[model samples]
Target: KLDDADLKKGLERSISTDIQFLIAGQNSDGGWGWWRGSESENWLTAYALLGLHEAREAGYAVPEDRLARATRFLERWLTRTAELQDNATLDTRAFILYALSESGNGDESRAVELFDRHTLLDTDGRAFLLMALDNAGEGQRPRVQTLASELTARAILSATGAHWEEQAPDLRAFDSSRRSTALVLRALVRVQPEHMLLPQSVRWLMIAREIGHWETTQETAWAILALTDYMRASGELKADFSYEVALNDKVVLSEKATADNLSDPVMLKVGIAELLLEEANELIITRVTPSEGQSGMGRLYYSAWLRYYLPVETLKARAQGISVARRYEAVDAATLESLGAAVSTAQVGDVVRVHLTVNAPNDLFYFTLEDPIPAGFEVMDPTLLTTSHAAEAPGRERLDPDDSPFWYDSWTQSVIRDEKVALFSDTLPRGTYEYSYLLRATVPGDYNVLPTFAYEHYYPEVYGRSEGSRFTITPTAATE
Candidate 1:
């Protein structure tokens, strides 16, 4: 909403309730994840802190300890990542800067230095980058203005104004496309409110179906916030004109606003008025002007605004995160040969080997890998889990175990009742861990092996799934 809107007491209460829910979802680590019950993520934690800051500024009661812990978590994250010098994605860097700026922290300057070293290609990345730079400080305004112009230049104009392609070629992914458009519109409007593209973008947004009530919370929130600010700034909400309210073609009330006499600006507190509002209502406003012919000509443009609130009981918050893991399946020659079976083809009573590999690019706790033993197969021996050396990547500098004693050990556990095999570690560093297990085929049949999933063990949110492999077990030939 807008400051001028003077949202009714009821609406304000609803907003307050939502804010409380957001505050309660903060993780024990003083950070927030994308969804409830999710492990702390830097960007999500930033988003939560920003919302809390807004609520606190708006005269709402926010716990000081919550904010302090979140700030410390963010500062610690920045220090650790910088020391590692890992190749951080553009979105991550932008979000970190945004968090620092919005938190009233002095480290925003450092975040700005990190943000300046990259060129963001994705629309989401660039839009957030602009937002981060804007919040970074007054000193960064010049850069923000320049980047806003660059992004505006890249926007692809359409019949409905401008939109962004998903990547290079795919323009049909309209959800993400619209989200990007909204994000860019927000950024550009902040830096260049008078830009020529404003009307086209605003017009396109206005005509879209349920533009303000998008399915995704982020899209909906961004759209509503952007449009409200734009409309308020443009003076489209003037209350000087006469207005009347009606329901089902029946007149309810009429008033002629005298803008000069009113102390308040264009804001109208219509919803709070005593008029009995129905499930649906229509309002009409007319502005009259004197013409050269000495006759008054009236031009009427009707605009309708609706506000809907869901009962707190109906709102359910979910936590979300990204899982990263890989699977490598191969027959264990040693185990198979121990049973005197051929090495190339699997048969009844032959041992099958599976090597589940997890790539932990980010710090993880209780990182878990879960593999379901395929049907018709039974565990032949204990599981083997080990960590030798982390996989090397192009730009990542792998931490040496000798240098940093905080290394992870892989441990395997099998639940016989659930027929599931799991490998987990207490603290997984930014590297790779492997889990291998052997199972003996008990029946001769072709089977579709289910995919194995791996995720952060604390939150248990899946990050990756293995590509399933199929194997045919042959019946042992009758002895001649």
Candidate 2:
């Protein structure tokens, strides 16, 4: 129902909103940080500038003043690195150079001079420098060819496709082999589109996706750019083909696609009740060939997903790469003594502590933990005052001598919600961590505690959870 004009307007509006947000987050120094209000950093600022430049090239109206200020910040950063002789990584320097060149604010001769100073360069560093030179209209230079050749020589080729790997320790959290391969592929597409490894490298990136997209945002962005460049260079955008989807030897759907709808996705949904069988069921997809003397060219990509749910109690504990375990213990409010791990019953005015233990076999990024509490208990917020009855209870003054109520070793943020306590961390190294928080048994009732769950924010496949528990609270002597 929508036409080209409608799509154009929608895209423009989206870009305008994004530009406004990016400008609003820019610091007074004209640089960006990992998050708003944080100290500005070099790499994040360069990444933002590159995005703005690309937006402008796509015919979006970006404020000239904002771009100029960001450009000056990057220039100052590069100058400081040289003046102080800081051992900045080659990849960082190369990326900054590429961004400045794309914005038409870089000196080609100086960039080349800096590039020559680095005797050793990683895969990312070489790719960025090649793109920088290409942006500066020096793509045909001898030095550029040398860099391109070196990259091609070091590629990891296989029957499936070709790719490059990243071995830098500092970039492990933010970078991966897919990202490195995408960047190198883009550079090669610009410098030598006829190279023998181009097709295989493109294949590698296409098949490396987790499902519909790559692992991280950085990886997805670079992969899209690389594939777009390859498409333009090879004139492979047009398509004329028909495909059929068959389930259990019966055709369920058939469709034709042309250049206009080549980018659109075709979805087919069938209920399990209709397709479920006691024996194995097969679903097959086939591309219909053109008539005699007709030809079809291009690629077809598809993904199949099966969705289902099960009862919480039926789900057993699983640990792909990370594991979590939780326990509860009742404690005396006055003496601060441990009352054992069994919290099956507690007095109405007693305090209970919830402990969570997590173990990671390898480094994981953007980790999160959620532990749901029983309705009969109320989470203790350290910032608020305790109830009057608990405050007046004997030995209550000795509960916290230093006024510190929580104990956690490795978490960036912790939040207490109405029914659950959540903990978050940007990165968790390989180790064991324990976190504990206090709760008060305010109401008298029997309640069920939900399971404690934890997982990597980006890759949900790596996750773990603990079994649920139950507890009961009895009325105090005064209430009884």
Candidate 3:
């Protein structure tokens, strides 16, 4: 039984911790990167600035110097990009303008100038620009209204809900269609809360969520912001309702909700064995009318998830959004020459290069690849100092740049574990990429190599895997 005071204190503590982390990660250039120690980027800096500004608005303490430095970085970035007239930077420019406006440092004239220069902007970019104009106190301006109308006209409405689509590639790894729609929703909620499409847009956002969460962190944050604004504008916070859940015409659960417990979730669990039928199972939810003169208000949202598992061998390689294939090649330990492909037999100390080919038809963020090795083989740790035949020093096995079979840019980080090699990237653009790592046959035995798998870290629905294989490592002639 937590009270509002407890929740507020917890939220403030979390905000304070996040603020300290952001401050500690600020680069020397008064900006942020995809991660600490990476190069500082303009949009990343603006994002951090916006976070700090929101914290300050919420009564959290934010260092003035930090805010000033980040503001200067965005200002300088906007000026330089404007001089270059790079159309590709339109999204960045609009986002920076919005950040500046939210922090009370925006220039209305400058925002108008940017809008004039970039007449053609993507959905998210246009939304940001609209937000900037609104924050700059130009929400009623003719041009601003025109932009808002254009956005409203582009809304894709269905019987159940409405949403906007993004045609341009995302500016950052975390950007997504959900985030773009959420941004547009926020802009409309602020500029025209009474618009007929606003409620439908909010419905679309709610429906698009996977369970209770969005696709990415950025999408979730923006969606929450948009939904919060919509709730406040529409006065949809209070709840007073009774609902019942039925399974196969049998009442399973019933509950009444009120304003005091509107945020609480009603959950029901049933074991598979308890199911009434193996197929065509029906679960229904009904909103019950209040007795006597009492009335019902607000809405009830529910989600149902079916959990099951299948044999590992029954699962085939899936290429719904991403595909991955792996092959093994035996190579000369001394000359680094390829001996053969799909080499199943190798002498002790032989080097085997495991190659993974990944094809992503669309841009993906936070992708990871995992390749499990046979127990008889040991990974060649590139970070270690070793003289083993397979443990070639980093940068020693060089190949012609044009003739190289591996794509080095596919991954930003890698780990060599005892039985697997894992590669990770913040973003994987639409293309085919090949990555390879070395392994040495050590123990003499027949071993099974587990399937190599890859997937988007945040959205596991997009995933792929390769077939497993067997390998045989023989003892050296001298040892025999």
Candidate 4:
């Protein structure tokens, strides 16, 4: 299988694409971060490095500067003093150690010290660290060897349930997901290379059928990676191992699990190796030619993979990678009391939360405004803007005082785009603006403070879009 040139080409393309995508997210400070403009996560950076190194070894053209920056990213953090200072506390140290080991660099003194401190939790960080130590063998710090073995036992050993205080306890026996089980197996194999974990690991992957770590593709990939590693180490890579193997989002490797030699882990090992190799191969082989204008590495990959995996009819119906900007605008009707007591002018001398009623559906919608705000006035919580009645399609309920709308501080001038997406991206423009609400101000009588909101939606579907409200305030209030 290793001699197959076609397989190598596919693997090379798939891995190189993955690494390049990760590298594209590198920050100016030489660290990799998740999402846009967030603080750097050292563990992710290390994984990027390790992934890059693996791809390079597999014949991918990973740029040298990117790899150096990835490594230096961790080095800079390791030596710096901050929330990331204590190598013993951060999971990053484990990831860094793994990358260093994979790099075949000598004298990872700082990394070893961190592992010696037993900082790795029973998560991905711990599993990878143990594997790195095992790969390093006697050269690894004596303390790491001892601690890794102990931790591995804890992860793989079965229990009635999750017992935190017992020796050789299982942290996730209650977790019936393939993702958790895979992590447990990762740690276990690192501590005991050929140790048999078929009963539990198989149950985790096959029974629970949970390959997602809550919500991500990493769990499936990681679990398979661990199983393949175990099979290779145990010399079980000669038979056809069976499970679900997805080449793309459209395909899952749910082939028949070939009967294995009950006494031998060989058949399972061989079958998994094929899937791993094929999965990588299928990622690079494209059936559809993407137009040069397509954006996003993963998006393009998804398209290509779908072309190969999905039926021809479905591919024709699938929409290209075009994203539409959608919005929902809401307006509330005026009641007698709501309109009786009026707020003529909202001033800047208090802590405020805006709660304007709107008719909106269950989908996420953006709220755009043509107004500005005073300084110090900011939305305390844009996440829970819409009342619980939000999820009810179209229900009614009083909001908490915090949910009430008011001017907490004076605003100056700025363009504000309040992204009222239900996921709470917290991605608002960080500046002050003078707010000119069209809602309550709809009444002409001395700013008759409308009972609910007024409707000026960018899109017609936006009802109850105020689920996320926008506000502002000045540092200096009228009281000051």
- lDDT-wise, the better of 1 and 3 is 3
lDDT (tens digit, per residue) of candidate 3 on 1-480 = 346888878987889999999999999889998677777889889889999998998788999999999998888888788765544588778888998999989868778887886566777878888888888774536767877898888788788688887666554434566777799889988888898888788778887888678876778989999988987787666777788999989999989878788767777998998886657889999999886654687777777878886654455676768887877887776776566667778888788877777787787787888888788888777567773554443221112335464425535677778878887888876777777777777889887667788888756667888876677889998757
Number of the top-ranking candidate, with TM-score as the measure: 3
Of models 2 and 3, which has the larger TM-score?
3
> Arrange candidates by lDDT, highest first: which order?
3, 2, 1, 4
**Candidate 3: residue 145 Cα off by (Å):** 3.2
Report the number of backbone clashes for model 3.
Answer: 0
Q: lDDT tens digits, residues 1-480, model 2?
A: 235787878978988898878888899999996556666878788878888888998878888988899988988888777633322356677888888887878768757876676446678878888888877774537778888988988899888799998655343235567888999999999988888898888888877876588877878988999999988787667777778899999999988767788767788888888876788889999999875543576666667767766655455666878887877877777744456665678889778877777787777787888988887888877656654333221111111234444433445567788889888776777666767777788899877667789988756667889876667899998878
Give the 10-residue window scoring lowest on summed lDDT in candidate 4: 298-307
For candidate 4, what is the lDDT?
0.42
Residue 2, candidate 1: how far off, in angstroms?
A: 7.9
Error of 4 at 25 (Å): 3.0
> What is the Å distance of residue 35 in model 4 from its true position?
3.6
Cα lDDT of model 4 by residue, 411-479, tens digit: 111222332211121122222212222221111112111112221122222222111122222233333
Q: What does candidate 4 score in Cα RMSD to the true structure?
A: 17.7
Candidate models: Cα lDDT each: 0.59, 0.76, 0.78, 0.42
Kindly provide the TM-score of model 1 when superposed on the true structure, using C-alpha atoms.
Answer: 0.49
Question: What ordering of candidates by TM-score runs from best to worst?
Answer: 3, 2, 1, 4
User: Which regions of candidate 2 fall more than 4 Å away from where they truly are?
Assistant: 1-14, 58-61, 83-88, 117-119, 270-282, 292-295, 306-308, 328-354, 360-422, 426-431, 436-480
